[model samples]
Target: MVTAIIMLSVEKKHINQVAEKLASIKGLSEVYSVSGPYDIAAIARVQNNDEISELVTQHLAQIDYILKTETMLAFKAYSKDDLEGMFSVGA
Candidate 1:
């Protein structure tokens, strides 16, 4: 799966509403109200790079209240589960 971290800058009054709407998008897996230069961070997982484009263009672009968005493509995944398995090898 291809995973994207989408950072959003939304109109101050529409942050919560936009977060709720974003959570419902087909490929988006998680939505968060965060503190930073961006107001929201959303995680989207899909089948390929093209799906990422579709999610941004077809789905996200339709939200009128979103002021700006920055999408980052993940090249690798590392987690606690992966670390445990790797350290246990031949032990």
Candidate 2:
């Protein structure tokens, strides 16, 4: 699987609209409304790199309220679930 973190700068009034739209997209796993330089952060997981490109270029880029975006590809993932399983001393 391929994963990407997308930071979005959305039109102030349309933040919720944009976030809701993002949540309904096929590859997007999570969407968060955040404060900072960017208005939202989205997590995308797909089968391959080409899917990521299509998701960003075809789907995400077409949203009218999203003014700008920055995408970061994930090289590795470490989650609490994985850590807990690895370090468990007993059942």
Candidate 3:
């Protein structure tokens, strides 16, 4: 599986509404409203890198209040107990 962290910049007044809409998207794993260079952040999981790219371009980038997005593809994970048993490590 592939995972992405999408950082979103949205219009101030639409923050909550946009977050709610993003949460409803099928592949979205989580959403948060934050204060920073961006207004919201969302986590999504898909079977491939191409799938996540397509989803962001075909859907997320088109959401009404979203101004911009920066996506980070998650390559490795460690130290988080909640995710400790979630994936197998290989060398």
Candidate 4:
């Protein structure tokens, strides 16, 4: 799975609206209204890199409330399975 974090910069007045709209998209997992240079942050898991482009262009960019966005792709993840295996003393 390809995991991506999309940081959205929205107009102050449109923060909630933008977050709500983001929630409607299929791949988007979570959306948070944040306090920082960006107004909102979201996490998504996609099937491939191409879908990222489609998500950014076709979905996100079309939202009037979203002014800009920054995306970070994760190459690896630390899951509960990883932790469990690491801490296990014996089989």
Candidate 5:
């Protein structure tokens, strides 16, 4: 799986609407309203890099309320599930 971290800048008064729309998109794993230079942050998992391009260019960018976005591709993932399995006490 290819993982991507997307930072979004939404238009004024449209953060919730933009977040809700992003949450419904396929391959979007998580979306959070955040504070800082960006208004929202999201995680996406897709089958390949091409899918990432399509998701960003075709889907995410088409959303009317989203003003800008910055995408970061993940090289490795370390999840709580993986950590627990690696350090399991038994079996």
Candidate 6:
């Protein structure tokens, strides 16, 4: 799976409504209201890069209240369970 982290700045009055809309999108895994330069954080897991492109430029662009977005592609995720699993392969 391809994972993308999308940070969004939305119109203040529409923050809640925009978050709800993001949660309903098919490839989006989670939506959060956050504190920072961005108003919302969205995690999307999809089959490939093409879907990520379409999701941002097509689906997300269609939302009326989103002011700006920054998308970052994840290279790897580190976790204790995953690390342990990798080292325990022969045990």
Best by lDDT: 6
Cα lDDT tens digits, model 5, 24-76, are 99878799999999999999877799999999999997899888999999997
Candidate 5 Cα outliers beyond 4 Å, as residue runs: 83-91
TM-scores, each model vs. reference? 0.87, 0.87, 0.85, 0.83, 0.86, 0.87
Candidate 6, pairs of clashing residues: none
Residue 31, model 3: Cα distance from true site in angstroms:
0.2
Encode model 3's per-residue lDDT on 1-91: one tens digit a residue. 7888999999999999999999999778799998889999999877788889788999897789899999999898666485524543441
Provide the lDDT at 61 for model 6.
100
Candidate 2 global CA lDDT score: 0.89
**Candidate 3 backbone overlaps, count:** 0
- TM-score for model 3? 0.85
Cα lDDT of model 2 by residue, 1-91, tens digit: 7889999999999999999999999988789999899999999978799999999999988899899999999998877576334333343
Query: How do the residues 1-91 of candidate 1 rate in per-residue lDDT, one tens digit apiece?
Result: 7888999999999999999999999878799999989999999878789999999998999997999999999888877566335434555
**Candidate 1: where is the Cα deviation over 4 Å?**
82-91
Number of residue pairs clashing in candidate 2, backbone atoms closer than 3 angstroms, sequence gap of 3 or more or interchain: 0
Tens-digit lDDT string for candidate 6 (3-68): 899999999999999999999998898899999899999998887999999999999999999999
Candidate 2, which segments miss by more than 4 Å at Cα?
Answer: 83-91
